[model samples]
Target chain A: MNRSILLQSRPVGMPGPENFEFREGSVQEPQEGQAVIRTLYLSVDPYMRGRMSDAKSYVEPFKLNEVISGGIVGEVVESKSGDLQPGDKVIGMLGWRLYNTVDAGSVRKLDPSIAPLSAYLSVLGLTGLTAYFGLLDIGKPKAGETVVVSGAAGSVGMFVGQIAKIQGTRVVGIAGTDEKCEYLTRELGFDAAVNYKADNFQEELAAACPNGVDVYFDNVGGSVSDAVMNLLNDYARIPLCGAISSYNSTEDVGPRILSKLIKTRSMIKGFVLSDYASRQAEGMQQLGQWLAEGKLKYEETIVEGFDHVVDAFLQLFQGTNLGKMLVKVSDPQA
Target chain B: MNRSILLQSRPVGMPGPENFEFREGSVQEPQEGQAVIRTLYLSVDPYMRGRMSDAKSYVEPFKLNEVISGGIVGEVVESKSGDLQPGDKVIGMLGWRLYNTVDAGSVRKLDPSIAPLSAYLSVLGLTGLTAYFGLLDIGKPKAGETVVVSGAAGSVGMFVGQIAKIQGTRVVGIAGTDEKCEYLTRELGFDAAVNYKADNFQEELAAACPNGVDVYFDNVGGSVSDAVMNLLNDYARIPLCGAISSYNSTEDVGPRILSKLIKTRSMIKGFVLSDYASRQAEGMQQLGQWLAEGKLKYEETIVEGFDHVVDAFLQLFQGTNLGKMLVKVSDPQA
Candidate 1:
């Protein structure tokens, strides 16, 4: 038996559990050039909120009453392809189900020796690559320049801060909790971390970057972004990655920033990981090198069981997860 | 006696006549390497509003009780330098006074035979160069793409629309009045023109750009910009030149556009003409060629007399100028 989560209905503002449905069905046998993989881990991201809507975006919207799909890591249970065999660990954009019977070509085989299989779904996957291209290619932080990252406790933001630090920049982070703020400075070695939920957020953010912001990696856009915008230096570059703050709000109104941008002669560019698809290998190799050298570190909050997938996804909006948020469906055979 | 206007006080919101004070004084004698220039035409621009307030910006704020300086075309009345002679036409960033005695190198000599002295302060000058760089460098409007420019009847906007047309792109103009709209489409060769003040502005804008906006040259950045932003195509480029709509308003608030930008993977860059100083000659040469070829045309709403400089500058906010606004201080010696 296979249990799969489906988009029950479209969300209006903030999505709730009622918008999703879990259906049980019989597992299918693998066809030629196909592999039946048992799900190990499935990644949930803030950007996924955009996919739930029917609007035209970078990625296609998920169909109603159909199986919802995202980044999933699995172990091959049965294989009809010559390349994939039982016990082989692979990762692909597969459905949220206990068993995913997909074409062997669709999934990339992962070696557990280099790093744990779960790491591929987090630090070494789209999340880390998002941070890599957005920060280096767009933000282009120079040494001794100030780099500010919003959602600095999240997966992409964490990597952005670390990579900026590696580039010899003064890294300032904006998060929601004091605990996350401490973790960013103490664990991630961010030069400064300010809690956005604090009453004195504006004052704290201004104080964090004494030299003014040269590069701003925006994940959560709103008043938080407005504050950072005021501190932009001449020729500042902003890589607009995600607007998690406005994801659930129907009316995302704020102070117009074009005047401020003109005053500083700055640039703000929006991008996604797919924009750098041709440079995937380059990003992965660099991120892996950084991980091996102890220059980069990552954390993941894994929820147990496929039944808790929706709960895990919902928790992302609440800012409960420290880093990458994933759900463990089953353990790989030893 | 030389007449000059001084910044009497900084404006709180919209500037009034009381903010300026006119005074009379004797003209200074020319020193070594200096030439006394009789002011012919002085430019009144929207960007001057920013200088009126004591805000730290790309240009310094106007000093209280000091002469407000800007782009001025004048005639040399007396010279102490071999480079300049009496009756030679020149242009420079000079004080708003009848006679300015300054260093010869401070002003660039202009030949009246090449083009009218007043043209040097309009089409063949900074206004035209601003449109050239902002449209080509940042906007990057390609042939067959749709280019939309706000404030399309203004000095820079007129050049922008015409240049986009020259690039073989479909040009759309957004302006305040129907007369301006007609002038843009009929007189300036714009493919389409929509009055932003019309009741069904959004509908009209959508109808105007069937292919969607590929390049948006934003000059008025408030609700009018919000309308155009919704019609952006993938990889759209926005060259933010000004925010005239919000220039006087204390709170420049509107819908947040980072989410829309992310959906299209677009870029919005705020730039001043000075950013492309190295390529000034190239821009000027191209503009001159276009004007010579009759592909580009310009208009100046010259308010005669130095006393009306304040009124002319204030009229910019009212959207009264058809193109560049200039104060005709005195006619060049025939």
Candidate 2:
């Protein structure tokens, strides 16, 4: 039986599990030029929060009573074209479904030996490409410069700090907890990490970036960004990837930024990963090398089951997960 | 004797003429590499408001009780260096003074036959270069795109619209009065013009930009900007040239922008003209050719005499000037 989760209703502020509804139906056979893929994992991302609202955005809003969709990895159980055979693994923007028989054109087949199946869903996928381009192309961190990243323990932020460190920059991280902070500094080789939830966050962040910030990779916006923006050096470059802090908040937030940009002669650019698709292969090659060399490390906060995919997605707004959050929905058949 | 304007006190809100104090001093003789020059024209700009305050900015605040300084056109009356001679026209950052002996290297000599002497202070100067780079480099308005300019009757905004029109784009100008709007469309050949002060400003602006705004050259940054911002197209580019609307306001005012930028995948870049010094020669060459060919037209509202410079500077906040506002310190020669 195919179990799926649908967007039961549009969310008001922070979405709850009740906004999602579950359905079960038997799997169907593949048509010509198609494959039946069994779901292996579902990636939960912060940007998905934007899709819940009906407002115009880069992507369309999820229709009520329809299946919620995003990046997914699965193993093909059957195939109907020369391009694929049974037992091949694939990844696509398939959905929160236990089984999907879709067009072969929609899914890219992945080799298990190249990397783990979930790595294709994490460091080697959207978040990894996001960090690589946003830092190197937009942020352009120079050696001996300071690079501050908010949400430094999340999927994208973690790679941003690590990549800046690789470029020989002094990295300062802002996270929600001391645990994430510790992991950033001790395990990830970051120069310093400060917990934004603490009373002394602003002071600590200032002290950590003594030379002022030259490159700021913003994953979470709001007051934390306002404080960080104060320390921007002349010609600072800000790669605004996401604003998870105010994503679920109904009220408008963020300080006056145009004046700051003018005064510091700095620049802030907003970008989505797909905008860099033409250059994605170059980014993936470098990330793959780093992962293989042990220079890049990643962690997954996993919740096991198709029944818990909605809960995992809800946890993104709560800042409850560390690193990449994923739902291991029925791992490839043993 | 030299007449000068001094900063009496830093302003609290909107600056008044009382904040300025007049002074009389003697002109010093030319030193080794210095030449004595008489101020011919003083360029009064809205950005001067920022330099009046003791707060941090791209340029240092006017030192209390010191000669207020900015872009000035002068005639060298004596020679000390081989580069400049008596009666030579030059432009430099001198002061609100009638006479001055300055380093010859500090000024760039201008040919009156190439363009008028005061034109050196207007279309062939900083405002011209600002419009060139800000629109061509930053805005990157493609052919058939809709280009919108706020403060459309001002020095820089006029050139921005004309340049976009030359690029085969539909140009829309936002000005303060019906006269300016009529001048922009009928005289300057803009596709459309909308008065920002109209009762139905937002509706008028929307109707004017039928295809939506692709490049917004913003000079005003308050409610007028917020209304314009809502009509941004996908991948829109905003060349943030000025914020004259909120420059004198005691409080911060503007819509939240990070979300807007993300929604449109747009970019806003704040830049000073000098930041493009490496490309200035290229811009100057183009602007010079345009002026010589009668492809670009410029208007100047000149307030005669050194004593009225402060009043002319104050008039910027009132939006009284049509194009470049200049204070004629003296005739080039009597």
Top TM-score: which candidate number?
A: 1
Q: What shift in Å separates residue B303 of candidate 1 from its native position after superposition?
A: 1.3
Residue B91's lDDT within candidate 2 is 96
List, residue by residue over A138-195, the lDDT tens digit for candidate 1. Answer: 9999999999999999989999999999999999999999999999999999999999
Candidate 2: residue A114 lDDT (0-100): 80
TM-score of candidate 2 against the unseen true structure: 0.96
Checking candidate 1 for backbone clashes, the offending pairs are none
The collision pairs in model 2 are none
- Minimum summed lDDT over a 10-residue window in model 2 chain B is located at B246-255
DockQ score for model 2: 0.54
> Residue B219 CA error for candidate 2 (Å)?
1.7
